[model samples]
Target: MSHHDNKPPKVCIVCGMPLKDKNDYPGGDTSLDWCKYCGTKDGIHPYKKLLEGMAKFLQQTQGMSEEESKKAAKQMVDSSPAVKMGKVKVAE
Candidate 1:
């Protein structure tokens, strides 16, 4: 298969370590290059859609209020192991 057709090799942006399946880099936006750990440390993800959907799902599935759902989503994103290590920063 061509390089484009093959799955991108996962690499930790922080330490440049080869990531395992359990530590698969979150794939959503190209702009956010940092891995999960680093992303969390920086506080933001390339794809807000995934985070928003996760928040909505939590709210609907758990019968949480809008605010609560939002909070839950934020927490999930904040606590992500990848975010903590990836340290991705959104450009201004």
Candidate 2:
């Protein structure tokens, strides 16, 4: 089997959220590339600002510490394919 099999998604390309299982979040399928908060079967869930909000989301939802959440959010965003391709900008 490939390395992808049985492994949960690492991160989201559109919103930079660390994804878990397909049903772990409300709208995500995990079988896809982005998280439920960022996308759904129909289309993307639009958001204006992300940098701070992502960190806040992680903290509030996952119980990550303030500093840890910020750091993790930054890392995910910086490495996402969408960001690399200029399709998304967390700071904007």
Candidate 3:
């Protein structure tokens, strides 16, 4: 069996961010599958909103061009655990 078989995933399902603390979760709910940036107490953000936020963060942190950051964000979200598990969907 996998090491994490019975444990919560160590990474956010939506953005693939490392979940290191309760503060990293939405409303400090450690049982959440997504991160603070990817969701709220209500639910996960819509796909476009999630992508835009991630792209902006990538551009700011990585010094990437707007187009490049958007591309990277889309790729990251598309391959995220949430998407793979059908918890989140990305349209091509």
By lDDT, the best candidate is 3
Error of 3 at 63 (Å): 0.4
Between candidates 1 and 3, name the one with more favorable lDDT: 3
State in Å the error of residue 41, model 2.
14
* True-vs-predicted CA distance for residue 40, candidate 2, Å: 12
lDDT of 1 by residue, 5-51 (tens): 36765565542445544344445333344455334434434646435
lDDT (C-alpha, whole model) for all candidates:
0.53, 0.66, 0.85
Worst lDDT 10-window in candidate 2: 42-51
Superposition error at 24 for model 1 (Å): 13
lDDT of 2 by residue, 20-83 (tens): 6666454544466666665566644433445566788889989999999988877766676877
Which pairs of residues collide in model 2? Answer: 28-36
Per-candidate TM-score against the hidden true structure? 0.43, 0.47, 0.84
lDDT of 2 at 38: 59
Model 1 TM-score is 0.43
Q: List candidate 1 stretches off by more than 4 Å.
A: 1-47, 87-92
Per-residue CA lDDT of model 3 for 33-64, tens digit only, reads: 78899989788887888889999999899999
| Backbone clashes counted, model 3 | 0
Residue 43, model 3, lDDT: 84
